[model samples]
Target: MLDSNETIVAIASPTTPAMRGIVRMSGQSVVPILEAVGIKSSQAKRAQVIQSRIDLGTPLGKLDIAVSLWPTSQSYTGQPSAELHTIGSAPVLQSIVNVLTTAGARAARPGEFTMRAFLAGRLDLPQAEAVLGVIEAEQRGSLEHALNQLAGNLSRPLEQMRSEMLDLLADVEAGLDFVDEDIEFISDEALVERLSVIHAAVDKTRQSMESRGGNRSRAIVAFRGNPNAGKSHLINALVGREVAIVADVAGTTRDVVSVETTLDGHAVQWVDTAGIESRAQHDPLFEITAASQAHALRASQNADVRIWCVDACHDDLAAQRRYFETHDGSSKRSSIDIWVATKSDLIDSTQRQPDWMYTSVITGDGVDRLRDRVSQFVASHDKEEVGSIMGTAARCSGSLAHAATCIETAIRFVQQGDGHEFVASELRVAVECLGEVTGAVYTDDILDRVFGRFCIGK
Candidate 1:
């Protein structure tokens, strides 16, 4: 999938009119292509751009251009590579690409440049994926995180672990090889200790990916409650905009409405869902409303924090308890629950002041407090993840998790007095899993899935 034998050429800039654009060529024919464009020998490893117009083919007109050359192995692709800086025009770039192809260079494929780097051991699988993350960064935090990944902060530990695993596997395999002689090449005590070390490292990596690395996915904060509990109003209040429709009618919100915001540079999804009710709890098979409620419940379940709103004017404390009871705060990835007393302005001394945040949309009181609290919640939950050592990629995370599973099974095998061959086999599988995450091992299918998201010529 990563064929780097032939010289490849591509316009590396956006195909739009701009002040400048880059055209990249890599591999063996790069020198000839550079010379064909009138580059001097001293231009190697220099950023200086030589200005000139060269004859591109007979009828294709001369183009004023500048060339930056990296004539040795230190290039991005770890081979001879050059960049053509020219006026930004799609046709002009295509013409230049055509001229280069005529000079025995083929057009580069999507992500071929970075893929070449990965293939040539310039970047591992995680760092390669980080390139896409860097390109697709929606904010500063994500961009910095991508840069961290590109710097190999995540790959170093995984490589170390893989190295240790390799040594242990070798020792176990040696025992398996001499089983007929009853030779204990690696003792049960020593094997147990070694496996325990690898197991802890694998488990630590898994937990980091699950928690601190979790910000790689969207963080959802939801407003949920009984009908007309000011859920929509609260959402608008918190986001500082009227994204959700505000109304006095019961069951006004029959669907989930979302608005995105950033708190402390961390992205947040503020979700407003359909009001909770007994009918929703029933979730009748024939009802469409039940489906929307189910969706809301799922969203709430999956949210990082759920704001449960109860109106101060009404008394549904018993029903709210029942609602919280059935949901059973116990869940995998369970959301943090915040009880909120809404319509605080209408509350009189007779009304019971619930042990929760009091909010009043009419008076704009407590809205700022809510916003600040939400911001604090998001910041506290995700602040540590920004620019973390481990790069967040779902595919890589999954591989690590599966690798941990394999290691745990191997540990169990060792503890159960399993055969050296069986334990060794499990170790081999686990090593391969870790290798996939770091790109020390790869397949065409894996490469396709990893690089397919990259733009052409990246």
Candidate 2:
């Protein structure tokens, strides 16, 4: 558990010198801190503002500041919070923070204020993450998504579903407790009906997370293939720099690494992900390898364009033909897939697939053609709507996907005339999964992952 009893202080505005900067404070001691700085406690009441000066003594003299106060526990952190706005000089801000700390305030940790708001029930998990998203957003579309999420556009439905599931679970468990009595707490048909609805809602949310591409302002071009297919070299060649590590060994890239550049006037982010390999998660030897494969798969799915890099010297053309014939580029209508024969310098023209693009980073062959193809794809979809999901939504996707599966299993149990206890167990897991999405249920690890990325003073 986190302690919220101590007074915390931080510089809330940008550190760059400007006309004004704000040093924010939260906790029961905020009023006392103001008094120590020479501002009257009474003057710093809720919604009240005071023009004041803090005497730093010696060379710095007294600095003019504006104080905005919420003397009661109803501020952003659900505590008595105040903001001291003064000239945005770096030294002045530091001096003010020093004054507050000496008086009674401790410097706040990164995202501590927002985390306190979450712990106090002022904002749910999704809303708290959205606050960070708003702070870090670089493009207009990302900002819009973050704002909408902050407004409860996504959490509202999930919260509603969780509530309904709780009611259904109560009914199902009640039926088990009264098996000897002549009362039907819940009908089998009703149980299935409610679970079906929950399943549908989970599936809808999952699809949105999966379909949302990264950063609409720039196109995501992902390189994917089996191990040692020259993906790293190709990305280096395209960017004209050594962004990804190149090696002759398999599985050199275990995580997704990307570089941003302009391709024929179109902004693009080229991603080099781990090689797609067969590995069993249950095996201790392949556990980490399997994780890397999963990361690669997710990157490819979110990409706007997948560049399939096939090793020209080693891969069998017949198998490649079969794979491409059956698989579509992507489920997303806007996404495209282009096959490329990599390391073309090592193979003869007769050995390469006629329809596929050929490229060799060593000899600089066909790199420009590959660039032009990706640029064309980006231009065609320039006007398409982007920003399908907030980045934070990625976390909820797994939870919601699991909830959907659990609900489906519960539905099956009900239909098959399984014991009420078995049905209740499935519903319990399903409810917990939904709870994780909205933060009705959470662990310390979840909190750390969500808030650790925030900049201090947010």
Candidate 3:
């Protein structure tokens, strides 16, 4: 379906200094450009040659180039395509693209190249989405998932389901047309069975689409305790950076400090909140504002894990216990509350605290153990993958929901002993809902929204 009217060109490389850069061009003009640049070759076939300088007579100077060409049928967009590999200098790359544009090629729009591939039937919507996934992926797990989708892992199952739905629809239409026929083309029992299979398949896909990795979960980890509890020091130690302001004075951390980091391939947001206190009058007016402090307290209460960072050198152990005892008890059980004693270097070698580790954020003592415990908590709560299922997009999810409603109506019609025609009408509506998911009967708006998320040069 590629339009023959326009030619597209783009710099198919990251906008950073690298060893090599490529300027890709596709359409009818590619062959003429290759021939003009002294890289003489047949326009009927694809060819590539290294270090072949294409001298373009321009105002700047004669241009030196390397060229490769793919014939119309074999090219990515089903049009004549070429790639000019040059030194990794931005100026050289820009000069070549400028020369091509002057000769007659418009700069490719964002995602236009990939969009052409989709229109040309080279890729389906899911595979097209995977192209973007491969580009933006940062983790190994995410990269594997994207690669699997690109290889048509999800598409095969979706296509099977679509085929089943189409077969059922065709049977229903045939039954309606031959109303007087005695032959049972599609029995009531068979119709119910087909609908059940379709519903089950769609439901499975919906479940798979739910969040998988630890980073997708909204759980947070908060550091809390009395003033000078080494909260700031612990934050820096965990992230291996000096992100929070560390000071010897108490109440130094009056505001919440947060940072995002990955732990065991799971994304986590670490928060350091102001120390909780009993005396309200002594606190500053800004701290007293219910909205601000309440927000922090709520976050702490809802956190997946709350580390009560305590100072090991302090002698008032019982007082600290009493202080936390007076506060609300609901949060204590819900959150994984662990007592952490910082500055283990200052404590006596013989003395030990019960159910507590000797942690020195400064010396990096027992920090690895702490990180291991956090990783364990995340892994235990993550969902397991059983049967293979496709991750549903927002549009697919909405379509499934609509189809479910239509199926419910069909079920009611069957139970009420409505005429076969009425029951068939509701089933047709159900089939349409399913069709929308696979782009069989999609609106223009749906198509635009799906493809619009892609990058221009894709």
Candidate 4:
């Protein structure tokens, strides 16, 4: 539990200059400091209320400040808290913090305020972590999911699971302890059934977490093909800027160039790699070394989507198609490949249009359709709902995987008719692993690692 006596202060607003800013303080001493700063409390029948200007006399003159005082047990951190709204000027804000410090309030450390709330039982471990998630969220889907978790959506289910596990553990312990008395609290069949149900529920929760649509939707898409495929032109058209150098000369782009864009509201890192071909070694930077080829292959293998651009004006579209058809057999199943026929404006009037898209970056012809196709591919292919899944954090993933392993071992033990105590021990380990996810058991190092990412005011 946090000590109410140690008051802390921090600037609550962003560091950037703005029209207004706020400095917040919380602890038992906050009310007294507010009073000293010219805020007077008055008794009205049964309750006390502050009814004066929040700003006290300044060295130069009276400053315009808005202050709200929250008394003990009625504040966010479960302590007396005060919020001082002042001008956004950096100097003015710094002065306010200095004054607060001089008045005995110490500067708050990173995440100290939120950590205090957790210790005071105002918010649990998962909800507190959600605060950081909400702050760092880069997309709307992630923000919504994090807000849902912060509102106790995630914690409610975990609490129910924990309670169920505790009840089962109690039954097993009672059965083991009073075996000689023949109490028969839990039969072997009944124990196995309960364990099976618990395992299934945990597995379902893990799957749900993995399928949620949020952070996982963020992916990198790389454009790769043979020489003079108009990859640079396509990238520039997508981002609506001169993000990459485009030239009619083959192999103009010898390195990877990238731009950030949102496709159908999903964040994407679009990269244009050097054209792949059999070329002689020349300039070290431009040379297609074995390492460079391996790197390109690795990027293609790892990309969420690969757009294979074929220059319709020169290259044989059918040949490019055949190459990809053969390559698809050896490619990773996770990659989504698309065929793009570039420089379509130069196609002959009698030439037949292939099944692939025809795009001309110069005239912006078919660009919209290309973008639509890309969006459609992402929507149809990467349909996993990341927000409902469990493995957003490495720690959560490790815990759930560990729990699954433990449960699997325990099931084997039960099937082999092993000692009941051994089965119980494995089940206990599984429960402990789940407990780590909700921070039911945590060390100082764990706490530091979790909260260290937060800003000082949060």
Best by TM-score: 2
TM-score for each candidate, following the candidate numbering? 0.62, 0.63, 0.60, 0.61
Ranking by TM-score: 2, 1, 4, 3
Q: Give the per-residue lDDT digits (tens) of candidate 4, residues 284-311.
A: 6444544555566666776777888888
Q: What would the per-residue lDDT of candidate 1 be over residues 88-127, giving only the tens digit for each residue?
A: 8888888888888887899888888899999888999889
In angstroms, how far off is 241's CA in candidate 2? 37
CA deviation > 4 Å runs, candidate 1: 43-51, 56-60, 177-185, 210-392
List the global CA lDDT of all models: 0.79, 0.82, 0.68, 0.72
Model 1: residue 439 alpha-carbon error in angstroms: 0.7
- 180-278: candidate 3 lDDT, tens digit per residue: 877567877877777777777766765455443212553478888877888888878888888888888876776778888888777678898877754
Question: What local lDDT does model 2 show for residue 177?
Answer: 88
Candidate 3 residue pairs in clash (backbone atoms < 3 Å): 110-456, 111-455, 111-456, 111-457, 215-267
lDDT (C-alpha) at residue 264 in model 4: 75
lDDT per residue as tens, model 2, 367-397: 9999888887776554332432444656787
Q: RMSD for all candidates, in order, please.
A: 15.1, 16.0, 15.7, 15.4
Q: Give candidate 4 regions above 4 Å deviation.
A: 1-5, 43-60, 207-392
On lDDT, the leading prediction is 2
Sum up the clashes in candidate 3: 5
